[model samples]
Target chain A: MTATLTAPPARGDERLARQSAFSRLAGRPEIGALVGAVVIFILFFVVAPPFREAPSIATVLYQSSLYGIPAVGVALLMIGGEFDLSAGVAVISSSLVASMTAYQLSVNVWVGVLVSLVVALAIGLLNGYLLVRTKLPSFLVTLATFFMLTGLNLALTKLISGGVATKDISDIDGFASAQAIFAQSFDVGGVSLRITLLWWIVFVAIATWVLLKTHLGNWIFAVGGADASARAVGVPVKKVKIGLFMTVSFLCWFTGMHILFSFNTVQSGQGPGNEFLYIIAAVVGGCLLTGGYGSAVGAAIGAFIFGMTEQGIVLAGWEADWFKFFLGAMLLGATLLNVYVRRRAETRK
Target chain B: MSLVQLTGVGKNYGNITALSGIDLEVGESEVTCVLGDNGAGKSTLIKIIAGLHQHSSGTYEVNGREVHFNSPREALDEGIATVYQDLAVVPLMPVWRNFFLGQEKRKGLGMDSAFMRKTAKQELLDMGIDLRDVEQPIGTLSGGERQCVAISRAVYFGAKVLILDEPTAALGVKQSGVVLRYILQARERGLGVIFITHNPHHAFPVGDRFLLLKRGRSLGYYRKDEISRDELTALMAGGAELEELSHELDRGGGGVAAAAAKMLEQESKELGITPGSTP
Candidate 1:
């Protein structure tokens, strides 16, 4: 029983060398986003004089950090093949919970923050549990959650405070330290940088490591690419998906706390439209809506582009209404660019 | 002792019997080929052995000890791994990532990227697979290359019994030959290989034992020495029924059917079995 014939190698060294280094670089998902970011930067630097100032640069980074935090989470969740439509309202709900609980009960602000964290995690857990148990689309499940949280944020805020906003918590015990940790800004090189910027960098770094270097990261790609195939190979698909949802909620809670302490008050209607911003940033960063292909660093760059574009328009003395149109154009452009890059990469090989 | 043994194993889904009275054995370092046509209980048998399904009757023994597996994970824990036709590799992921998909090596709080890359490359090389770049996405590989990767991954992960579901079924002649070589390599490394296919030409080359299955029941199990390739093909294609179909076609029509019937008679004569013989 020794009639087996070995197959000749399909490729040779000459053919392998034919793949130029530049083509390989062009295949990366982040390359398009990176190029877009640089082009946007150069356009703003030349046209918007105020944007060239160091303090203005810091402000843009600060704004980017605010969106960057949740965008990083959204990028991971998107790569894992799901979305959290409630992410935006969930942030407001968290801040409202923290402000109202601390103001009404007169408890230390730290306790309110802890309670908000728990609530955020629970919402995430519910979203994941329902998505897995009912086998419904995450978009629908999170959409339902989005509406519910929006209603609750208003109703609960008004019910607790007589107005559609939480009472100011600036005078509350532990307010000073909470504000320092969440909202304080520091000066560096004659420019002020928000603490949120530091946190944003940390989030991006950790997420990039997880997506590229760990077993869970592999499982995320596997499950997102094909859940049935991943399960067949013994990857814990359900746990990975649930964990991604929870990660997104945890970031939402963190961002929500910053919003609460930065302003010392939270308006119930503040979070409804922000979820779209986070999704846009992730998509711009090269994460596919279909999942299993993306980078966290790309999401951060996407946020930076958003921040620059929004501020650049103001600096250029353009109407604020034009910002929405620019965002729409960028989203469409980035998605098309990403699709082309992916096709080129896959087909060339 | 046999690495895997099934005695009187059977399965039923309410009223439909998928498999029954299946007696099979696979010894270490031997390739036991399971031959069958479509809907001949091949999938059901693979599922049962791979722990995707439980046997409804009789016993399944591993190393002389009766055991039941509730999931593929459990079967993997027992050193039984099934490489499905789809290969279970994420197409967009790199070769090293797909090779260690569910089971990845870690260093500190992060994955050991350097170690995983080196080991995956070395393992493929050890299996005589020359991959130009392990960083390339698994989807870039041809069908034969992908099958070889799957086999090498199973071997590296300490799979004592490897169940391959149609590894060469979706490949060309040269690609199929490549997979047959890998199957022999796995057998040489002392793993019990269950090679399932419908092609006797593919099976007879490396198979030490042959189990022919037809419509949920075992037609018969024959050792390599007990069965010729012609006998195996005839049995798999329907021995007496095929002969009867040829005679019916010879009388009924001309052109394609008549030509096919004449070819069937020639094959039967070469096998020393007359076309009309019942048994």
Candidate 2:
């Protein structure tokens, strides 16, 4: 009976090996993003003369890192079958907390940063808790958080600083060290590379490792695939989801700190629309909105594409408004490509 | 001693009685087949035994000690693994990942991917399931192969009593045969198996004991030697009720319903059951 069900012997082992190898490469979640990045790079390199320069490349990398850091977290959350619509306002909220607390209390910048971290994590926990306990859709829960945070960010900033932006904290104690850690740039082959770029690489590396080399990685996939089934098999569904939301909050705090210290001031309305960019990067990186299938590295590559396009259009003398159109196209195209790749991989078996 | 035993076990949900007066014992190296049609409280019974739900009244024992499980985790800790019909597998996840989903091997804060992949492949092979690649998503496998994976996962996890819920209900004849073979292999390995199904044809050959259920109550439990396959099928289909239906259809003749009734009468006769006989 087993012999009858086994694969045909007529297909040589060598052929089977080759087929699997090809399928594996094609099946990778990041393959679409990688290809998109390469195409965007080539297109910009051909059309934008300045894009070929090292400094311009560094600038693109810097911009990519800004979105790449959070996109990694968003990808993981999405893979776990949840969304954080508040992610955008959450970044601004964190920055506002850090800046306002530093100036209002006249405390060390590091102390303000700590306060901001707590605030961000609390919001994330609330999102996760409400999602699990109320059994509400994550989209609605986070959307509510998004609106609340958005309102608070603006109102609190105005109330505290009497302006739409926080007071500059560049002269506060520990500000220099914080800047060095988060916002400082170093020369790389005569082109100054922002430290955020290094942070982005580290973030992507850690997120990728977690997704591929940890039990939590398996849980994320399982929970996203089928929560009830995963629970039946002993996977802690609620904990994984809560942890994922917290992970997003932690990333948002990091990004928020970077934004605050980099400029020494944060605008009250700076983060409202950026959440879509993070989601777009994840989707363009081949993450399905339905969840259970995606990669952190793919999201990183997706952000890289975003950075290149945003910079490429400016360098190529095209209107920056066209960037949104390009992003929309990429999202649709990447999703279609990912669907096709998944079908091919499954059918090969 | 029985690996798991239940006596006068019953469950109530508000005003409805889901199961009543169920006495079952699953021993080592044996298959105790629970035969039931839809709404026969099969799911409720398994949920109670698997610790998803507590029995409203009964003495449930594991290893001769009374036990009450609050959750499926407790049940698993007690080595009673339930492989649901859906297989409890993440469809989009790779085979190795699903195999070691909650129980993963770790090395220095990271999963031991190499070891997990190798062990998953070996375990599946040991269970006589051959896959082209363990890295492939489990959704790519056939329904039978997925069920086999779920069974192997339970066995690997040290389940002393394996309760399978309709493992063959959605499978084709060949796939059903494959799953039956796995059940036999599991029994040979000295694991007490509770094979739940409405199909007696699939159960009779592999089961050592048959427990027939109807309307949330056990009709009776029989050893393989105490009952013939025909008798088992007849009982599962409600022998007397089926006979009466055949006569009714015979009265409303000249249609497909009458034809089906005629076929039922022929089958009943072959099984040595006379029409209109007591159930």
Best by TM-score: 2
lDDT by residue (tens digit), candidate 2, B8-34: 999999999999999999999999999
Candidate 2 lDDT tens digits, A282-318 = 9899887778989999999999999999999999999
lDDT of 1 by residue, B104-176 (tens): 8878887888888878877887788867678888877888888888889999999999999999999999889
- Model 2: residues >4 Å from true position, as ranges? A1-15, A19-23, B244-257, B274-279
Candidate 1 CA-lDDT value: 0.88
Q: Per-residue error at A94 for model 1, in Å?
A: 1.2
The TM-score obtained for chain B by all candidates, in the order given, is 0.95, 0.95
TM-score for candidate 1, please give it: 0.93
lDDT of 2 at A274: 89
Instruction: Give residue A72's error in model 2 in angstroms.
Output: 0.4
Instruction: State TM-scores per candidate.
Output: 0.93, 0.95
Whole-model lDDT values for every prediction: 0.88, 0.89
- Report per-candidate DockQ: 0.38, 0.54
